[model samples]
Target: MGYPGLHRILWTREQFAVFRDASGQSYVVDAYCPHLGANLSVGGRVMGSCIECPFHGWQFSGKDGKCTRIPYAEKVPEFAKIKVWPSCEVGGMILVWYHCDGVSPTWQVPEQEEVASGAWVFHGTTEHFVNAHVQEIPENAADAAHLSFLHEPWIMNGVDLRHTKSKFWRFMKHHWKAEWQPEPDMHCSCLIVKHSLTIFGKHFPLLDMMISARQIGPGLVFLIFQHDFLGCGVMIHSVTPVEPLLQHVTHRIYYQRSVPSIIPKFLLWAESIQFERDVMIWNNKQYLSKPLLVKEDAAIQRHRRWYSQFYSENSPKFPSQNTGLDW
Candidate 1:
């Protein structure tokens, strides 16, 4: 759940249910009921602070996933418990920790004062379902060369990378310069970008921006954007893997109240169009564990190395073509 105010969400394939308690604390747990294998999220009701199973009225605590009560039975079984996941709410998002080895979270999601203090107003959000590995999505931030070739075209030309290079839109072009580096913390990285737009060789002062993006962990990113005319805002970008090859990506933008709503809405629309161009390529690309790298591609390799720390020896691997059901 990238945004706030969502009470329950079920990932059917993963069998993970994210819900909140009566006091508004969020929790993540295995969706299946421990008693008879009934899906809890399908017909589960929040009774006080516990979740009541729709199948047999079994109540489970959202805090620790323990069986709170079995209405019709004399006593609850000792083994009546669900697998609870580590979760927390921060920066207006409900974040659930996922470690392949069932390890606890080593780092916490930092609270953004602007978001928590009501200083920033949520303007809008955009979501895209992409068929790609989770690593490939964040890797794009470190790939500086792709910015010139893939995203330099005008937004009006459309999201197709092939058609975007047409000479018809040559008069209007986007320019970008970026630098990425890993932070002192092992789990974070920062990308600083300078962007400008030109129309017929004349730069538009209002379109100039300096954006600082911090990638927190493998799936969450916070992009702080500042514009000369439109003021400033923060965009929360999150990536959640639903399957081995499918990911759910979302972007929620919050702007200062002084900035007009139309400014953020327009920016979100334009950003979505540009972002979809990368989505098209990511959906069809294959991940190469070893790739031919050049001098300019050093950052990509460095990013991969940094991201490797998140995996363990027992982490799940994609099944080989020969082993149909090894997983």
Candidate 2:
């Protein structure tokens, strides 16, 4: 990982190097120096807030990415700066994208009030990769049968090692409500099939909320699963496709707990593993492989239909205010 704060920072794909300087600011620059094609990140020197190139000792300000002192030069040239992505902190994690196009993109980061307002319990985040389409990654959240097999829950004795009948479930053509089965501790019985029992850490007492499905744009989707528990709790997960087979799944975990540390560290560690399970199942899948989809695949069909709409030449306005009718 380029950043020092995270538990683990993986460098894969085209990423060459990552660094966080003395200012606590993080930067991910190109691996190979543009000057003479030497890797600047390798054997680079960090002084103050500048990184000196190992090959020529050309010094560049880490903040602006501009070559300030050329060891013996009067002025820094305009093209002295190497490519750098604008990065900032969110939910204890620092994110920086290597965007080449200099277009200052509108903030696509989810406008999360729960996390921003800081009225919740503990929160954390991690980066993962899914070799499948981004849309297909979170699709497992609604998959019923896979849980009994993949996530053999010791919490559910005798429920292990048995594949339950894949339930074909979704919202009514009207508004959708995704709630846990067998009711929660507050114990509400009414719940649709597209819900997992969101136990405090593992299973049970799944918080209830109104679920909305919208493909914001081509290769982009924003699904809203409002978690209204104990008072007010909601988190939005934005699943965006980077490539046809790769995705960036970011979760904004918001909760209303009595105290921050009430949830012990063991549970948080387990929680992270639970999340990694999703990434593993998704990244390893071969979506194009033809498989048997019974009537239970209805939700997948609904999602596919939603996805097809975006490809339409006359696609309707996305992110349109949900009329409280179609979800």
Candidate 3:
């Protein structure tokens, strides 16, 4: 958690509040108070291990979400309670478990020594709000064709893929060779990518690098990058859905102490330029359940089948304009 305070979380039109007690234990509960429907996160205060409602002097236990006290009433009602969400702190994030069927978490978020220990120094972070389905963002890793068509030009040529043929980028280009595969675990996948810079068709050995990314669950990814000149580091990529079609994406980078500080700054800058190219397309594109695919686009269909495990019969679907119903 950020601190011992109340934090509001808005996920897909549902409101929730995360309370961190003085002892650093986090609890997630519905944002609206059960008594009077007052937003708990607006003016709520933590009393010992309970959260006090702002509209009424009602206290709810952080551990079980049962109404502990009501100052005006002599005895609290037996049925008075608030919904409590399962939560845990892992990999420097306070994650609240969510499932369409209200089932317990089937998998746990993995931890890394580079983040738990002080060996890897924090360098920089980049955050973006992408207008797309959460599934579409991770699918980019499996769509290898986009690398040459969208991101082949150097960062200096700007984020517009249409202008990559300009004279300014004639001599500079980026090369990428990547492979994507599903791990043994049904909930996880992996992508291995190799990148290099070429000027006048000559490769620069110093700029060559390899990245191994592990996609965990629906919204978390850990990418480890190794470069001959810049050393090794890990980037934590997180995607949280704020609405049905909007996602909050963040990337945090950490490197060994031997790496220069300036290197990460330059990497983040260049990475942002490349990432924005995909963001522009996702914001305006429509999701096609049955896409017309060619032989070269086989991986895109494989990714869809692998990702289908995240959905269930009760899962929410985007509202369809044709039928005026959720599909």
Candidate 4:
């Protein structure tokens, strides 16, 4: 990272540099210097709020990305400002707001009590490169059948429970529910899912679980999973589109300090391994805008509909009447 200094990064197929000043302020703009096109992020020095170009000592303001100083020039041109992306620092994370149509952000990333409560510590972080569209990735949350089939807990226990199944038994074995609570006039929704599995097999009862996923737009998803055994934990799943066929995904896990830290750490490791199953399939799958569906695929459609607001031409809107849905 090039912060308090410069850091070079790439996203959406474009190269950019991020700089943080001594005052703890952060800024993101074009990576290369405007004068000679030198990569400013690599060798740039921070002078107060400006980043000094390494090649000629030309300084650019971090706030507006404008050329503020020139060692040899008579005057700094009015058009010396570099392209600056709308950015903000919140909850120890720097978020850059991007709009395809050049619209400003209409909604803010809400603060999470789980992290601010001071009871949770950062457990771990997992990063993965997925060869898929960002929109197609989160839809997996709606695919309930995959949990029992693709990521079955019994399979981890070396028991193929499907072989002993009746349809009702299979349904009862992993009871899953998904509810999409769309926030009025906001580009966000909460997808809550509840499910259970026999982790202890015949030795103990089913491990009941509840997942509350707050999706802020298409790229950021914050998850809180409550379980019968592992207690409560949070995950920040952030995805950035690299290309049409590629994405950068980061998963940050946090757990309450009251619980044994190793338990959540072990759970994070297991979840990392579990995600590989989906990775294998996502890397090879084609995107279908209109996919064939069954009775169990209702959530997929609802999620898709809610997701469309991000890509649509107009601002997100909701019905005037409240649905009385609880988060």
What TM-score does structure 3 among the candidates reach? 0.93
lDDT of 3 by residue, 1-327 (tens): 355788889888678888888888889998999888999888998887788899997999889899999999999999898999888876567788899899998888887787678677788999999988888999998999898778888888887767756787779998899889999988999999999989999999888999998999888888888987888888888899987878999888888888898887787778888888899898878888788989888999899889988888778777663421212
Candidate 3's error at 209, in angstroms? 0.9
Give one digit per residue, the lDDT tens place, for model 4 in 258-312.
8898977886776666676678778878767778999878888887888776774
lDDT head-to-head 2 vs 3, winner: 3
**What order do candidates take by lDDT, descending?**
3, 1, 4, 2
Query: Which candidate has the highest lDDT of all?
Result: 3
Give the deviation of candidate 1 from the true structure as CA RMSD: 3.1
Clashing pairs in 4: 2-6, 2-7
Give the distance in Å from residue 241's predicted Cα in candidate 1 to where it truly belongs. Answer: 1.0
Q: What's the CA error at residue 11 for candidate 4, in Å?
A: 0.5
Local lDDT at 156 for model 2: 24
Per-candidate TM-score against the hidden true structure: 0.92, 0.54, 0.93, 0.83
**How would you encode candidate 2's per-residue C-alpha lDDT over 79-111 as one tens digit per residue?**
977765565555444555423244453444343
Which scores greater on lDDT, model 2 or model 4? 4
User: What is the per-residue lDDT of model 1 for residues 85-199, given as tens digits with 9 covering 90 to 100?
Assistant: 8888877777888777778889998877898888888999999999887788999999999998888899999998779988998999999999999999989999999999999
Clashes of 3: 0
Instruction: Name the runs in model 4 displaced over 4 angstroms.
Output: 155-175, 199-206, 227-229, 312-327
